[model samples]
Target: MVSSGGAAGTSATAAGAAAAAAHSYKQLKEEFVSNLSGGSVTEIAQVCAVAPVVSLLWSVLQARQSFFEPYTPLAFIVDFLLNVGALLLSVTLYSNAPLLLNLLLLTVATFIYLIPADPSIRRKKAKLPPNASSKPSPAGSSPPLGVLSTKPFLTNYRGNMLVVTCICILAVDFRLFPRRFAKVETWGTSLMDMGVGSFVYSAGIVASRPLLKEKAEGKTSPLSTRLVRSFRHSIPLLVLGVVRLLSVKGLDYAEHVTEYGVHWNFFFTLGFLPPFVALFQSALKLVPSYAALAVLLSVGYQVLLEYTELKAFILVGARDNLVSMNREGIFSFLGYLAIFLAGQDAGMFVLPRALPSRFGLSKRYTMLANMAAWTLGWWGLYFLVTNYRVGFGLSVSRRLANLPYVLWVVAFNSGLLFAFALADVVLFPGFYGATDARVEKDMYETATSKVLKAYNRNGLAVFLLANLLTGLVNMTVPTLHVGAVTTVGILGLYMVTLTGVAVGLDVYNVTIKL
Candidate 1:
């Protein structure tokens, strides 16, 4: 579920460099091929492999007119080298490194990069004036938590409400519709259930955009804005899907073309959030903050499942009837919406504290701290998996909304995030040191500068790319088979590559530095 950092370190020029930079992505693809073929060139391969990711992180940190902008590029190189070194050493010690170690490295590096420090390069890259008029930021901008837009609140609200309503009603229809209504096995059932639920979650964020109106006037929205942002971004894909539908036979090219399909899931849903949030700033005053939303969705849903079993008719799976399925109708969307909010909120809350304030590891002490934190986190995760011997199992998947299942996902999420935080702080030191706490000034103003600028600016694009990539992976790989453990490796690389590339391109395209 973790993704590579997006393009945000350097000015749009750097992203252009990366895009036009023939050496990066191609080299990375070769590295993947090497991994499969067992070819040598591991050292050079590793360097090329990690460089883009590091570069992207640097750009994100510098995109904001922050104190740390000067240090982003250096931070990128240092973190990149450190992560690569860590990977090499870890691999030398073992045949394959664990996921926990990788996450820890990223987390620690990111955290260390936020703190301000000394500049690495004498002549810094010239950033576009923060007030430049040539570049108009996409709706989403700023850190994930505070990310919002300046659009009318009602506009977002109405759109989101409709999407959520669609999902709820569809979910209900699938559950209770007559057999004739569902001619294709569970076609109407599964599609309506999951599709409608996800859409509603997406819609809610769109509706909530007005809450962040003050923040979204000019800046790009953060990744957390995905619940709504996804919807907005998907409009193109959705339209393309319609075109594809009308142009081609439903079963001919359409059914088989998973990779190239116009319709998708996560990205489309994530794109609408920033605009929605921008539309409704006053809304935040009335509703709970992102954290509360997460707790409300997750814990509240858990409680309802424990106590209420009114709508069990629709929740048809291995864990059916544990709690009523009816609660999931609207509440499920709420729950998912909470998680989406939480992801963005957590990123915002934690990013500033994690990275150094200036640039270039201020001192050896911070670097050591970053490394130590990562080591401890990695060790803790290793112990948990080894001691508990909890293998990945779909048993929980069948148990929709089960407490244990939910907890499991939460734990996995927290662990991964903690690890990535440590890696970011330790490796990058004070990469994105310039992010000011003054988001109330304006959303657009806040976004152009910050460690997460790329994610804010191009989150929708990145989400779209990742979703499509994920879909392609799903289409090509046998994710369900017990023997598909090897396939899991593909997800790791996919996440890292897609996120970095998407972010980089977004920054390059959206933010034109003069």
Candidate 2:
């Protein structure tokens, strides 16, 4: 009887342990969700409020008489304080507020900042010398800034910085610090998702610029030639992917596919899809309507994927090493291709054949109106699909690249571009005005401009460098054991180093074109 009693006690103990384990798992999952959602909210607020304001300040500084002009100590001090204030407002206030309230406040602030106080401000021109020539320069003489300028829209620098920043933030979020910051899941559309989408879209715009021009001039190459060129461009990416896969073992296969694990996504997509897009351009000669086609393709692809359950098929054996053919890595290429096509379409519209010599008051208002209209239209589409469409929501599944995800990316990108453009118009009146040739030349030569150009010139290199640094830092440090302050300091130092490298490369006129 005593032995029977002991066995019953043992069984009861085992049951209790199992119940405790389940509870712990549930708690962790809930915490993870909360943190990620909060982080995403804060990130959106920062991009909307902080990033544009900072860009405005930079534009104002760049508009000064010269890049090297001497300034009073007080001026420097004031600038420093302003930056600090901007940072605090971006991080603290938005983070503390309710998500709806935060978004509303940001919208109101953005609108106020975009509105011109005096209508005449738009007509103000850069004063020229009496003897200066007034002849208009030939169109297309100036070098294109490659669709990634701070003054115009979501620049490459901003995107690159975001990637690096997210890497650092993730390091902290993943138990590196004492307290957790907001964290998102591998599957969901988070701030990181937006950042990646933006970066990819920017790349697409840059790649398609030359092609768009060629189509416009009726100089598109034959299909065979385009295919060969694309394959040649893809070779390097293939090699890099192979090398990275061989070198970086024991990495989480899930993370690898989810977070750029040495796969040939960027390289292969650029190499392969452009040829197809070019072929479409050549065959149809439909430059104006390509965007509509792209939207149709994105939605259609998502529907097919849902009907077929292709995701389940790919994921079944994903954990095994299958190189590029793995479910997580290969399927995303289609969605990415759609994004690229969309970006190409956007580029055609945003980068017009001719920029006006002078943006008069009425013209400025018209531009603002157009910006607002485009933003609203895209965002409205995003809202409609996510709200009404079955199985549609703003989940940026990088793996799936679903329809809702594509809409979200396009909408936010358009909105950010409009915000930046408005900021530029308000902050640098002379830039959009009928300015002297020399002044215009000097404007492009400013320190800010030079740095941005340099960073953009070797964008792939910068991305690779950041990845290398992230790996090294993870290897050398006990990331989870570090303090929050220490993590921030390290992140700052790392960013500065990356910026310095880009600037140095620019100084030497070095561009690592692949």
Q: Please give the lDDT score at residue 139 for candidate 1.
A: 47
**lDDT, residue 257, candidate 2:** 40
Per-residue lDDT of model 2, residues 1-514, tens digit only: 5698899999899999977865564445335334243234244634445555555555554343232233345543433333333333333233344344445545654555555443332232223321223334566555533322223333423533343343433344334322212324344455555656666677666766666667567776778887777777667766665655654554421123444323544445555665566566653555346567667778777777778867566544455455534554566667776777777766665554333334453444455566677779877877777654653454555556777667777777777667766865554544333233444444334323443455566777777777677766765665545675676667656655666687678778788866
Whole-model lDDT, model 2: 0.54
State the weakest 10-residue window (summed lDDT) of model 2. Answer: 124-133
Per-residue C-alpha lDDT of model 1 across residues 94-128, encoded as one tens digit per residue: 11333444455456546645655434321232342
Per TM-score, the best of the predicted structures is 2
TM-score, cand. 1: 0.38
> What residue runs in model 2 are displaced by over 4 Å at the alpha carbon?
1-48, 62-126, 129-187, 250-273, 279-288, 314-325, 353-368, 388-396, 434-439, 446-450
Q: For model 1, where is the 10-residue window of minimal lDDT?
A: 180-189
Displacement of the residue 479 alpha carbon in candidate 2, Å: 0.9
Q: Count the backbone clashes (under 3 Å) in each candidate.
A: 115, 5
